[model samples]
Target: MSGKLYLKDKLVDEELDLSMMQLTEIPVKEIEQLGSKVLKLNLSHNLLTCVPANLPLLTQLTSIDLSKNQIVELPENFGQLTKLKSLDLYSNQISKLPVSFAQLKSLKFLDLKENPLVPELAKAAGPCITANDCAKGFF
Candidate 1:
């Protein structure tokens, strides 16, 4: 759809796959409150502009897919996802990352392909072109 949908208070514990749904936008706030115990989320192929503020509240979230969106910046609190292990942000509009991102010690796999690279942040992340670079300690 061209518009956004707000489906709150829905208990979706099993894998909820919405791949290739042609969804343009999603209201993150309403979705966060619904899946309090959700461990994985897939929002690929949407027309998002920014990372959702309430994302970190999904304490159980270990994997998230935000590929092919228009996200330009990530929230500083994005690092607060201590339980997060895998994050997919491929093909977005992110130009720079918050320094706080390094705090995600639990992060094991991150994808940042097709996004602009901030040299300074890349330097801070230690010569890593992708999260794989950081994960491999290439810096």
Candidate 2:
């Protein structure tokens, strides 16, 4: 929580890498202050148990990495990230996705490896490893 204002260049254009920050929740205000300067967010390797409720507020996000965390659920309206093209949710505790997930029409790359997906999801997301294969289940 003290690192709310922490800034890391992420070595990528318009990206903010807050990975391994040991944060339980995202600093929505601080990230918002950067405005559209942040197009990608990396919150991997943290203690997060759930996605930030207001994360959909960052509508400019093109990619998000929430891997290696304790995420159990996504915001019901996560599809609000219509610009999001890549999503990495590997090694998490997620079991089912929200109905709104089908609305992510721009998503091209997805990684849901190491998750305990439900039977339907597992069938739809067959062999999710490569970018192309990972994106098969979104809709």
Candidate 3:
């Protein structure tokens, strides 16, 4: 899947906007080439089903958008993204999160609405839309 890569509006390496690329897979090599310079990466609105587990190598990522896609299961080590403060996984085919999801200690905002999640897992995850009401269930 060939997709365009763009610097986030000021020619800075801190943010990369790769959204709406119609990509079938994560551009791991390109992203890794960017190294720790990127703090945010947007992969939303694409055709990705599973992301490369090595994605966590970009340790500088503070936020990532994987919303509005066809992803069914995230990489098992996805929670290794400890620096991620915000994660948007809305409107996907995810039913249960990986057990390692507990490793996301720094995650502050998570959107899990509109997923056909398993009842138990969904209940445990709550809405996770806000820190006040859905804080305890984020895992």
Candidate 4:
């Protein structure tokens, strides 16, 4: 059940759709090299507690799905991926978003439905908000 998908010396550019696999944690160390060029990754419906630190290496990534997990906070470098366009974070246990979220200038689609963030906080983290805002949003 631990099959790996690779491409060239690096991992495949295909989507790593591992959603709803009843996983509690992923071995990021094993996949660090694989994510270097990965474009899309699906890690939703797991029991992840934190965002993978090595994810930033995937500079070519465009989309990521992390919904229905146990993540409480995003990494400070989460916005380093300037190529990222879409992010799904619905139905998680997240209570607050990292200030770095505003660094995602290329971000277009963001899903934050059914979180514990308040309305006021959401507005503060509007599309135009800055990293200094540190407020949540209804994306």
Candidate 5:
């Protein structure tokens, strides 16, 4: 079955929560239907292997949660989410990030703990530090 989408604490049209679904992929078209109204998305605790490259099309998004999934790599143009702020990718399988990751200038929070990251990249990432410093010098 397709994953279910819901609004924030209250059922609204501005955010989407698709967490705890057994989804292997995100429903891009379904999410696109929200248009510019969608500003946050939660896709945690699923079976996703990869994030769709078209995800950046939802430019209005400022937060996203992809933790506890099976994602191994992000889209090459992942940096297109220029307006993004908080991102959670903890407990996933991500090893390497795209060079474009440096483009997330607005990002303020990121969670990459528990992933078997590459030594070089992991060392570059340094000790887990929350807040806006999470993606510092990530290029």
Candidate 6:
């Protein structure tokens, strides 16, 4: 079944929560339906192997939770989420950030716990033990 949860509050017009859906992929079309109204997206606790390549189109997103998945890497154009502030990637197989990641100037919080990053990158990343710690890895 395609599980979906929609939320809204005074601050946000819309949010899409698809946690624990056992999904291998994100329903881009369905998500696109909400357009710029969507701000937060939750895809944690699934079996996703990769993030959607077209994720950069959702420029309105501010927060995204992609934790507890099998994802190995993020979309090449992930840096296009210039408005994004918070990102959770806990317990994934990600090793390194893409070159374009440096473009995420608006990012304020990041979580990269449990990822198997290479020693060189890990040293640069430091202890990704918490969201605060992960934020230190980047500018």
* Most TM-score-accurate candidate: 2
lDDT tens digits, residue span 23-130, model 2 = 898787888888898998999999999987789889999999999998988989998999999899999988888888888899888887888988888677677667
| Candidate 1 similarity to native, TM-score | 0.73
lDDT per residue as tens, model 3, 1-139: 1346543342265767778878888887777776677787888899989878888777778988888888888888887888999888888888888877788889977877888899997877676556565556454
Please give, for residues 22-110, the per-residue lDDT of candidate 4 as tens digits.
66666455555664546777889888888866666567778888999988777878877788887888777666777777778777667
Q: Write the per-residue lDDT of candidate 6 for residues 24-135, one digit (tens) a residue.
A: 9987777777677779888899999999888877888899999999999988899999999988888999998888888888898888778998788777766766666666
Clashing pairs counted in every model? 0, 0, 0, 1, 0, 0
Deviation in angstroms for 37 in model 3?
1.4
lDDT score at residue 7, model 4, on the 0-100 scale: 30
lDDT of each: 0.69, 0.84, 0.78, 0.68, 0.82, 0.81
Q: Global CA lDDT of candidate 5, please?
A: 0.82
- Measured over all alpha carbons after superposition, the RMSD of each candidate to the real structure, in angstroms, is 4.0, 2.2, 2.9, 6.1, 3.1, 3.2
Q: Residue 18 of candidate 5: its Cα lDDT?
A: 80
Task: Assess the local accuracy of residue 80 in candidate 3 as a C-alpha lDDT between 0 and 100.
Answer: 84
Q: Output the better candidate (3/5) by TM-score.
A: 5
TM-score of each: 0.73, 0.89, 0.83, 0.73, 0.84, 0.85
Q: Which candidate should be chosen as best, given lDDT against the real structure? A: 2
Cα TM-score of candidate 5: 0.84
- Give the winner by TM-score: 2 or 3: 2
Clashes of 4: 1
Model 1 C-alpha RMSD to native: 4.0
Better lDDT candidate (1, 5): 5
lDDT of 1 by residue, 12-122 (tens): 664345556666555556566565556777888877788766767666778888888888988878877878888888888887877677777778877777777677654
Model with the higher TM-score, candidate 4 or 5: 5
lDDT of 3: 0.78
